[model samples]
Target: MRRREHESLTAGPVCPSTRSPRYTCRKLECVFSLGHPSIARLLTIKLGSGHAACIRFNRSGDLLASGRLDGTIVIFDIETNGVARKLRGHTRQDWKCVLWDLQDGSRLRTIRFTAPVFIAELHPNTHLKFVAALFDDQPILVDATEELVVKRNFQSAPKRSQLDMDEATEKILAQDAKQTTTVTTFSPSGDYIIAGTNKGWLNIIETASCQTMFSTHMAGGVITLLRFAPGGRQIVVNSSDRIIRTVHFPDLTGKNVDFGNFRLENDHKYQDIVNRLLWNHVAFSATAEYLVASIHMNHHVYVWETAHNSLNTILEGPTEELSAVEWHPYKPFLAAVGIDSGEVHLWSVIAPQKWSALAPDFAEVEENEEYIEREDEFDVVASEELTKRILRQEDEDIDVLTIDPVKGYGDHQEGGFKMPVLLHQDDEDSEDEIEAIGAGQYRRKSPGRGRDRNTANEATHQNGRR
Candidate 1:
């Protein structure tokens, strides 16, 4: 039998005849490795009650407020991962809106209406104030600090001229009456409040006066969702017709508009299923450059470029039906989505890479090498002289004409037409002229022929007749 080599932990594999002991070499094993990780799921909290109907994060991002179909609102502390407060007293008919203290997971107040509350939004400027839309009544502004309705404006339905109408018209009118306000939001400046109805009517009301400034029908179906983009200059409206339109606020001219007509790629099989679900979801990015919308029952989120009204990307991670989606306030790439499976997911725009480098340091350097090199190459003296020369040239090109006060026209010569330059008179002179005119003592020049010329013409006509 052939002799086998003996291996030892700390001994050489060769025999002792060798000058130096040759130990068996092993690859180094690392305990820790450094690399850039791609965007992925961070943390998920299961509510046990299935899907949450609505979720909103406070301004400080310390607390998350979620409302469920069981008419309960749970406020969760992000850091501690505990339920800070639980609020009750709402019905499960529709989605409920809640307001909470951003710093602490404390329930500020809850506003309940007689009908189903379809939409609620906190005032952009006021912390403890918000607005809610009701099914049977008008939208109301509630002050959480005082726990009362500060402003309520009910929109009156259009009246018919004659009480006697056809049966078809009356049925149509009855259907219209059943429609409710579905969405409500405030302008960025908090100057105006916009509300949408199920019947496709959009009303823009001035918050200060509580009066409707403009009202128009946007589309035929319900207005599912409406959001005022950053800067509050434009608003995006999503209707049940699957048409997304961005309109200029305070104008509503519908001109120079950006529209996204969503059509499923291969939706022939899922058309009926998707039509049954209600899609009232829309989210705007931090910079308002991108918009993410949840397609009802489609298990897909469409990321759109607001400027071009085209698809930027398609997110297809949700396995079940989607409930809602919200974008991170500060991070443009990060977004949170809620699905019917009782799981909330976080997504980012970063792609996975094999050979990754540390995220480029955003820290500012006092003196950058490239900046210093460019500075040395720049001709500062020449630039300064050129700037001064351009300024001087602009000043020279400016024509500064002095306007002189009007002077009275020279005495009328012969029959030449002359215009008198009226001068501004003193107060006393104005008063005197007014009194003289009132007393019928001021004779105004007649624009027609003079009195002497008229008398001479009349005398010449009489002589000719004789």
Candidate 2:
């Protein structure tokens, strides 16, 4: 048996600068800044039924695939911008993970975990082979191409009796749950395969012997995702508890001295559920460099840089439900899923408008006088209007605001008042100018209002309704 000698450290969320909110970095002095582009729009790609859980893209960036609750895999051809093919295999209730071969789209694999899947990943060298784990069970390495099992091991899993939380005094083997909720890929060298479970355990396995090399408990919430740096010097894991942690592993040939092997140094925790996470999340200036992640149930995406260990920007919007999110392989653009409605939103992670951030500036005035006055008026209007709309639900005469520019604001426009929609123009000025410009600049682009305006006189003679 070869003895391992090495030290490991885990650093909490990379706070390039000391800031407030304890876990989060301060804004002005904050080292990490995620820039946003001028234009932002939620692009909708319709996937028929069942909530989409996970998605993967092929290497060429032409094919997009997603696994759904209905135990089916849907593939989309970006060139056609439509659903291309559907693959069926998992008979399980819900599909949890899917891996699309970057080198070859035909070589794909999907996992349907009976219990929630803790982690899943493909070997860096070969997409045909993949590994996944559930809870404290053994990791399953499958031949993706053939859908055959390659190896399964239970040696690292703790006995069922050891899971008793009350048995603190008992000396039991350790189990790793950190970075377990999501599968992780290893360095190109394939030196180590790490898995973190929901229970806060981290298991680092050596590929050579296919044995558990290091196991430790990462004290955070559920590890949602795990990613290794490009050169393989560091490893990152995030949990639903809003904590992002980095684990350091020395280069490949640097002697296997176990530098305590399991050291968790720094971590950053936030106040939300960590959702979709990715390495090289965004690309700026034609060079790809950014770590992007979205909160599971929230409408915000975080951008971090691996070089400096800092947050770059935050892109937010898209309320219903966020299922899967990923960055454009060669661009700073991003795409996310609204699971419930099957709405796909495309956003630029760089140079956001910062309109959402300016809310605090007008929040007081809006809350004090102007907001109070409108609140009373809006209440009466919305109540009367909403009541009528609800009653007319069965009838097609119901007129509802499909997409309001000021969605939650209580400023209900007057009846028949045409409003301009900035949706057509990708670039809208800052919030201040947008408000100062007034409603005149907003032109109503309602579904049926166009043709009638140009041919109003011509159609007036034939149609009596006008």
Candidate 3:
């Protein structure tokens, strides 16, 4: 991760008070709410219930899939604004998670576990494969394309003492005790499947071999989340104990560099924790230069630059606690979902070349101000400072943003674009200007920087060198 300078953002409109409704004045080209609204656009679809567990979007952004507590997966078509399909596979069963492939819509997969699923995810490049963490059973990697068959299962058993085994424990054991795997994710390259369990055990299985390449211990308790770095060089795991550890693995082919390291940055520590955390998510930027993670309990998200392990920006909001976070696939925007209100917040860490894309009315408002000045032909600037200050108070918790120039991710060949960073936190300033996560002030290269030496000296080099 590249180092980012922490600066205050004062350019944004002051957030409205929470007591009032947000209203936009089209003529004035300004927006004011009963309270300050941080979201630019929000579309709320009535779920069967108000509760939503997870949300996923297809590659084309045409379909939106959400899993609810009712064990049903809801699919909606954004273009038609209608229900595409309602999957009932997990409705009656004890399944913990459901995932829809962005590449194809013909298939939907669900994970059945003895325990509830904390979180699940699909590979960015594949459709048939998906992984889910089971609180009671092993994290199962299911091939949803093949009739939802289980391709590989990773079970982590908790260590038990012989003296602690009673008759009831033996009876429970005889009935087939279930194991628990708390977190799982695919490597950035999609070559490895990583999972963590309650025993502080971390396992990385090669997708092809289905064998453990790296399995190690933490102090104890379940690992809440596993995140692969953008460069795929380091794996960070969080546990029920207040600790976020970075583990480094050698080449999986039994090389000389197989080792691991961990660091605990949280202040408060719990003793003998039983239940794993529910909200655990990790995201990397487009350039794989930074990792953004939510600090448990505090309800604050910390941005960690990968270059020197420095904290970039600390993002906080009022009322709604963050449930999920995702970095833009091709841009520098970070999308965070609120758990309390089913609201999604988008934050742009970098500034786009054209800033008009953020608030559509900024340009129109500017134009109207210019026209009014021309009509009046007065040298006076509207000093509505006191009135404006009385109407909209400054937000002490929020700041204006400063964008650093970075190389934006390339567009997707299939139509859409993946922010070169899988985890997108940067926002695009405008449609034309793309936001890059960690792009710096490196000079742009010209087209003719590299010459075709072989084509120019085919005969001359062949005769001389041969």
Using TM-score, give the best candidate's number: 1
Q: Please give each candidate's TM-score.
A: 0.53, 0.52, 0.52
Model 1 agreement with the true structure over 338-415: per-residue lDDT tens digits: 443335544544344533244453444558556335556765667789899988898775546843323432222223
TM-score of 1: 0.53
For candidate 2, the per-residue lDDT at 286 reads 19
- The list of candidate 1 runs beyond 4 A from truth reads 1-51, 60-63, 76-99, 102-110, 143-151, 156-179, 250-280, 333-339, 349-466
Candidate achieving higher lDDT, 1 or 2: 1
lDDT of 3 by residue, 144-194 (tens): 556646657754543333444543466555432454566778876566777
RMSD each, Å: 37.4, 22.1, 23.6
